[model samples]
Target: MVPVTTTQIHSRPSLTIIGGGPGGYEAAMVAAKLGAAVTIVESKGMGGSAVLTDVVPSKTLIATADSMRRASGASGLGVELGDEPARADMRVANRRLLALASEQSNDIRRGLERSGVRIVIGQGRLVGPTTVEAVTESGTEIIESENVLIATGASPRELPTAVPDGERIFNWTQVYSLTEVPEHMIVVGSGVTGAEFASAYNQLGAKVSLVSSRDRVLPGEDPDAAVVLEEAFVEDGVNLVSKTRAESVERTADGVRVQLTGGRILEGSHCLVAVGGIPNTAGLGLEEAGVKLKDSGHIAVDGVSRTSVPGVYAAGDCTGVFALASVAAMQGRVAVAHLLGDAVKPFQPHLVTSNIFTSPEIATVGVTEEQVASGKYQADILKLDLSTNPRAKMQNVTRGFVKIFARKGSGTVIGGVVVAPRASELIYSLALAVSQRLHVDDLANTYTVYPSISGSISEAARRLHVHL
Candidate 1:
């Protein structure tokens, strides 16, 4: 963060933020730094759903699962990993993830206090445009500020027939409570969250069956990238059920029974419903405060995080914007910056990068292949297979690729998709290229370590240079 001189106002601008997730706590820090007297109203300790339940915990579990995957695959690489499933301990992994979540929440709270932001623990809501009411178990407190930001995050949507019991039937958040890996895990929903857990648990020595309503997994992601990930999932022994929706999930005498479309039955030790997330917008008094909400119940906000009513703003999953934690943090920063009259940049969807945490991760940013194919934008695209890379051969990596899209005439990098191990890490250069509008030649000329998988990124760019 760049240091900026405090605003020379007679009285410091006062900002009150509701919720303490990345969108709320990060904004409080920024608002305080910008010379605003900041206060945060939170009910879920600190770090909101992202840290306490969703992103942090799930990623931690995936890390353990990844370690297990590497250890199990070592024998093929001439490294004998004796006694399979020794390190794949679910109880330990669950305990560690919960500890990490709690610690992260505390850290965020401490950081907010250190930044001179006041923390109010309660369920906060908008009473009027600039007035917030926080209700706690003991009492209620009303707060008034020049600017109010609603950053309450979201929660996993429960199926009408399959409510999570936090036992055999679990939601994404409830899975962190597992004492043992499921003997056979039936995951419903083939989106990022579903695919991630399915991959992670399967890596952790569980039989995973992924159910998708679409014809293939990751319906919203790039089709080519989805193909690669689906292939990897199948090779890893994941049972892929496509074009079928779960009619119901019921616990059986010994395990669980999932009734799919057309009367199909899947029996598994556990069931996970990763259907989707609904915004935590109800009961927030948004409508009474003249804030417009979308039909989907998400708070509607403009680019600068301004809601329907002036002096009221909303960010994060609540706003139904890009759902990544990074995007939420940026929205919060933008909200505070714009509110404090500081230099600000509106949210940029085109520059947003997202990754699916699968065995072979899929990361993408900027213009999509669909948009280009539909003549939404005239751009040249290039895809270089990771199998052709030197590092991939050395690592015995067989799948995934680096795909880049550039302007048709100038070869300026506009978009990209990467499917490989740690594709999230390999995608930053492409994101930077798109953000900075760097030409293909610029990326192609950049230095990449020899025998690196990331070389495919620059190689893809180099290939695209010829398209123009």
Candidate 2:
């Protein structure tokens, strides 16, 4: 395809979106629908990290891995034992996941094309508030627009010495490249992603070791929710190396060795570095454009996704607002709405909901225990274990619970955590309540389905006033 000449540039309210991830692409579609001539510049595939690396591939792998776990344990529920416990053929699963990832990417590409948005497959750098330079396979092209959306997402952060080679040692994103499952996987970091991979592999018949710098797993999550997840991991036979800091990881001929700060060494067939992701903001002219980045290297944006620089906006992982796909999508929408002077809700970081895709997944919204401790709110908490729920009993699920946090005086539900099977689906009610600041009495008054796990959520809210 011949490159369009600079002379062919049309006059319109042009919107150039950098980084074609969920945030960027979604923003481009919205902008196009709003009659803005849109262009999306991307370094990688259209779906960016979520589709090409993170969300799509991980969830696809999880589906197959979860099925194997269920089949393997079916005998324990009085079902006749299969000839042998079903095993996960990672080679086959990897092929399936890659195909699904490709399909998702294509879907995004087609959707954008059909919406009259131009896609430039290359790196985009800001030349000015309304000018973006894209270096593509064909050649360099400058997109002069009335507005620019910086949606450049984040990349998996690597430890100084534990660089991934896409083989024995790999980051969370590169782990999907493996065609074979590791005999033993040592997951470094106890964060949400780390816990999810550790749990998935352990359930898929891989001996797993989780190294945590903190005293317990998922240290940053709700304390009670973390406790329940730790118990579930232990029950799944995951080797939890808690309070042991990872000094470095090196790959040897036989396996990978993780050296701890206290001089302990843990060996495993593969090492997964899930420490975290760093925003892809550097080398993008953000500094030159006068956009402020936070200490953690994330673009600083206010309530409406407007960055420190005027006429420039950023959203998604670039803004470092919770690092969730849903939040990223929301930020992108708000950024476009604010830019177009349309009716837009102010970005509310506190009300953004997130979920950890682990077994008996952890879903949460609003404030946390640390916030309450820091005097953010005078609140009381109530927790109800799933063991008391009839549906949980029917499903043979015992290791989970729901906890709700509410204002001490007003009884307004401010935050909540659900640690049960399909917790992502069950946490929406809590998310709505937190977003709207619904009172605990409002939840307690509503009726959940009979024999539903979500009953624990309402029951927990009912306990707030009684215990406080």
Candidate 3:
């Protein structure tokens, strides 16, 4: 770890980063390694929403739900549980979930501290091109630096008609306070967040209704993957309210009442609003400091993460460049590399691998069928059902498929999608193949364990190669 001191501070370029999320902390570490004095201004915990509220907490809840789901199916694997059914304890699960989030937050803080990045617990605003005014618990402090990176991140957007009460009506962040499971849960907005919560709670012994304005759940995901998930949702007794918008929500004596666009009403013990998130770019003195922001209020950043101002940069959800923590970390690293005059590749959004953490996780990387269908890129496609895989039969898992895309003639692995349990782990090989420009033949020739779910990847590549 580097040591910080006043003598050495004058000898190196100084960097100040706002918001201690993955984007800010990661950049601080990188800049410190490059011999720059770095300081981080953060009002929240070190790991930001990814570790504290949104990513870690939600995934922990999902893990508990997944374990319960698997335990209930253990009888099929010859493990009988008599006649009584297993039940989930929401209080214990919530305690463990919050503990895990706090543990992760402390770990991140220690890592940044060990890397010699000065952390100021405060809200920071840009006062000049390289000057930051931080309002801390004690008092205001001014920081002068050669480079400034804004990674303030984002928060859940709320609607006026349907506000979260943190009880009957809740947002994604507020759901962690639930000590008792609801009798019936209503989830509005069938995007990734809504679908995940609906699936999780249904498996956790709650009647769930998923309301979607789109024609299908997960409208942005692979069409085939969405179909499989929708089927599983219905099978698990999750009521699917498709092609309807939630107009307003009001608390009843016992539960909540949600009014739909077409004058239909749905009642539930609780309602979770997962509409979307808004970037945390307001009141940062951005416009006054000459930092350009998009109409949506996200800081506009270039490929290297530079803002409109020469020395100012931005990353993470605030930049609206893929709202994933992995992408945020990469953008932060790129920003520091550019600041230190290192040879760096521009951040590529197309190469980012993302996953939706549902029962059958949906993982995707590179190009998509939509991109090829747009007539801009020529590509060949192949789809292989997991039902054909021996592992699927062994595990009684019959709800996923693998789809791959390649160049029309050359057959280079351009992009692919995986829908299965632990698909997040499986997509890495395909991501590496696409990023490295590996041919379909390369993947086909690679040795995969017999009777493994990953075999489907190699087999799909082989089929594509044969056709090519």
Candidate 4:
């Protein structure tokens, strides 16, 4: 297929988007395809935080860490390395990850340009509800448009007392700059971001301490899955500091000192603050343009990605939604479809597929175990341990499960969770089941390859077939 030329897209559409993140870039592509001239203003390079700093870089680094973990375990599978244990050079790993992030950002830019969307590099703000002003390195450009979208994304939430200095102290973004591994790493937060980093660094030969204000790590995730991860962390020698908060983190002469609640103190070679994120909604003229924002500063948007004001919309982490790239992309598409008189559906939270990048990933879709227990939805649930799977035994994998939730009588799949190696890949089948409203019997009757982790999904569905 021939690519659309930039000249062809230069009509008076003036569809201006602030931020070149997942939400903005995806919206630009869809709008351009619909024959609308689109302009995207990005302070950072293309692909935004999800690609340039957070997801892409972190996952690339974790890949190397995972390889090291597998190598160390090869002896258990009757394989042996040389006299020395396989070590990862942090300098090499960091360089590779940053390079990959740059390449990904460049790829996103190429895609947008190929789609005939104009790229404006600089800060963007709403001059009015229907107008956007971008301050680029060259000069300022005022865009008057009937459609405007705010997808400025977010930054890591920081505490006043514990700030990231990008040296001994770091946030999620700054950790990529490390040229050497630390002897000890202290992570503050037990949620998805915190737990993921802790798991990766631990696998990378660092003594990790995961400090949590909750009872256990991943307080927002599945309890059963959390138990499996906590057990794994224990076996991996990760220090779990639960039900406490970090009062302060100060850089020491050698490393850093963390003062926890109850007057407890801990020292580490490096500290990572992963409490959460704050949307980049400030200085965007949101309120002046009559755009309502929540107390957390996230732009308030409806199911269709519309803000309080008309002709304006918001998507992605800036909206404080699911914060997944796929969800953000879909929200962007929905926004465009609504504007262009195309068929569009509201946001369906249940159909959202979420994956956590850890040793054994935790992936879930549709209704959650917590939601079910709270009587939000009634269903028959079954969990099958991977330890009992033939393929899992062959891989020497013992830490995961495939769980299915189906409604009684009808036996239609409503929710599912997979806690296993590459659960992200395994959870797609369950995602299809829940989204298509497929019945447990249908899943059970489906053919699956023998001695595979995916077989566990079919086996679990077969067990749930009795509910029919």
The per-residue C-alpha lDDT of model 4 at residue 369 equals 90
lDDT of 2 by residue, 1-468 (tens): 647444124666678899999899999999889887899999888889899899999988878877877787676677876577677889899889988998999999999999999998988999876789888888788888777889988999899989898899999888877877789999999998899899889878899999998899988888888888888888889999989878899989989999998799999999999998999988999888888889988999998998887878998998888788888888889989988878999888798788988887899999898899999888898878888999887777878888898988889999988888788999999999998889898998899888789888878887775444
Q: Let me know the TM-score candidate 1 reaches against the reference structure.
A: 0.96
Clashing pairs in 1: none
For model 1, give the RMSD to the true fold: 4.7
> Residue 462 in model 3: shift from native, Å?
0.4
Span of ten consecutive residues with least summed lDDT in model 3: 1-10
For candidate 2, give the lDDT of residue 117. 94
State the displacement of the C-alpha of residue 138, model 1, in Å, after optimal TM-score superposition: 3.7
How well is each residue in 62-123 modelled by candidate 3, as lDDT tens digits? Answer: 99999988988898888988798988899999999999999999998998889888999988
RMSD of each: 4.7, 2.2, 3.1, 3.9
Question: What would the TM-scores of all predictions be?
Answer: 0.96, 0.95, 0.97, 0.97
The local lDDT score (0 to 100) that residue 450 gets in candidate 3 is: 95
Candidate 4: lDDT of 380?
93
Ordering by lDDT = 3, 4, 1, 2
User: In model 1, how large is the Cα lDDT of residue 209?
Assistant: 97
Off by over 4 Å in 4: 1-13
Higher-TM-score candidate of 2 and 4: 4
Give candidate 3 regions above 4 Å deviation: 1-9, 466-468
